[model samples]
Target: MTIAPSDSALAPALRGYADHKPDHLARLHKIEGQVRGLTRMVDDDRYCIDVLTQITAATHALQEVALGLLDDHIRHCVQEAVRADQDTGETKYAELTIALRRALRL
Candidate 1:
């Protein structure tokens, strides 16, 4: 089961996010530049295939960031939860499982 962000008591779990804030910011900045380049490509009437190739590269880069964040969450947050207790730890594990499923689009 998925807990909606607005409904959850947990205040936006971002353990991994906080840990990698600088890295994420840097990657996002690069992605922003790529987006600007894509916009310029469109505005300058570049070839459709070239623009699409850029788009694909940008998407893959974003996915890499996402996977890294997810890994950190599992290694830090989820691991802590499981180590802390059994009952609620199980819940945390379930929560992480759901997250992994969603991340993997399973």
Candidate 2:
């Protein structure tokens, strides 16, 4: 889900990944191409192991993007919130913990 800053009072004026948004978009586009390739491979009845390998590659790429975003969030968004106030600090940290759990699939 895409949330604009206007959508939430707590939202930052600029996103954590703003500085590297272009890089992220490029990575996402590459991942999109990888997914399309995987679909084509399946349509062509390619070997099972090859398809799985491509799937793994795509998954890892996505995970890398996720990690990069997460790192940016910590360095920018969460840090700013914490520096602003104690309540916001606690809130952001809790939110970060939840996000980490979800990322880890714990």
Candidate 3:
């Protein structure tokens, strides 16, 4: 079997998430604000449970962003790689699995 270059090795004109990038950034910005709020909460000696709740919200927000990006990666990058060739497709799928492992902290 021949190894093929990964889709991620080359940059495409537009990424799968290109169209939704603005929305993604907006959500990230909101998460950033949530982080800043957490900082303030700690500094102000806010209740422990409240801080935990905010942390959970922030974590959930980040997870949502991640899920969106993952979906885009599969739909665009993986699909393109598979279209290129079976070897490239398999490579991309393996790469995605490793990435998911890291993301999920498994």
**Segments in model 1 whose C-alpha atoms lie over 4 Å from true places:** 2-14
- Model 3 Cα displacement at 38 (Å)? 0.3
Please tell me which predicted candidate would have the highest TM-score against the true structure: 2
Cand. 3 Cα-lDDT: 0.89
The TM-scores, one per candidate, come to 0.80, 0.89, 0.88
Per-residue lDDT tens digits of candidate 2, residues 23-82? 999999999999999999999999999999999999999999999999998998889989
Worst 10 residues of 3 by lDDT: 1-10
> What residue runs in model 3 are displaced by over 4 Å at the alpha carbon?
1-9
Clashing pairs in 2: none
lDDT (Cα atoms) of all candidates against the true structure: 0.81, 0.88, 0.89
- For model 3, how does the per-residue alpha-carbon lDDT over 45-89 read when each residue is reduced to its tens digit? 999999999999999999999999999989988899899999788
Count of residue pairs whose backbone atoms collide, per candidate: 0, 0, 0
Give a tens-digit lDDT track for model 1, residues 22-85.
9988998999999999999999999999999999989988988888888887887778778889
Off by over 4 Å in 2: 1-13
Worst 10 residues of 2 by lDDT: 1-10
After superposition on all CA atoms, what RMSD does each candidate show versus the true structure? 2.8, 4.2, 2.9
lDDT of 2 at 26: 98
